[model samples]
Target: MNWTDSLEIAIALDEAHPDISPLTVGFVDLREMVMALAEFEDEAEKSGEKILEAIQMNWIEERE
Candidate 1:
């Protein structure tokens, strides 16, 4: 998924890191985790604070 697919990325992250809290993750680590996903296929340089925040928010929602 691309940088714009925040919800999808969040879902994948939630599944991949079931024990970790998205709220505690910093943008740097979060971006790394997202880039590591098997389904993720986007340029690392494309990610920014806003995209990361959206992914984090979606991940928080996914957990709830």
Candidate 2:
């Protein structure tokens, strides 16, 4: 399943479990980790685009 589905299932499972906590299940931590990675990926892509654009603008021109 996708992220949303997995999230909903996690919630349901959490609601059902009295003995297990989020940390014990590793659900909360893992979700935060996945979200952080997604944000990092987005930032990295933006940085990469800026770097590429700068490189193109600063590239050497032909002497002809």
**Clash pairs (backbone) in predicted model 2:** none
Q: List the residue pairs that clash in candidate 1.
A: none
Task: List candidate 2 stretches off by more than 4 Å.
Answer: 1-4, 26-64
All candidates: TM-score: 0.98, 0.28
The numbered model that scores best in lDDT is: 1
lDDT of all the models against the reference? 0.97, 0.33
Tens digit of lDDT per residue, candidate 2, span 1-64?
2233333334433444435444333434444433343222222222333333332222211101
**Per-residue alpha-carbon lDDT of model 1 for 1-64, expressed as tens digits?**
9999999999999999999999899999999999999999999999999999999999999999
> How big is the RMSD of model 2?
20.4
Cα deviation at 20, candidate 2, in Å, is 0.8
- Give the top-scoring candidate (TM-score): 1
> After superposition, which runs of candidate 1 have C-alpha atoms over 4 Å from their true positions?
none
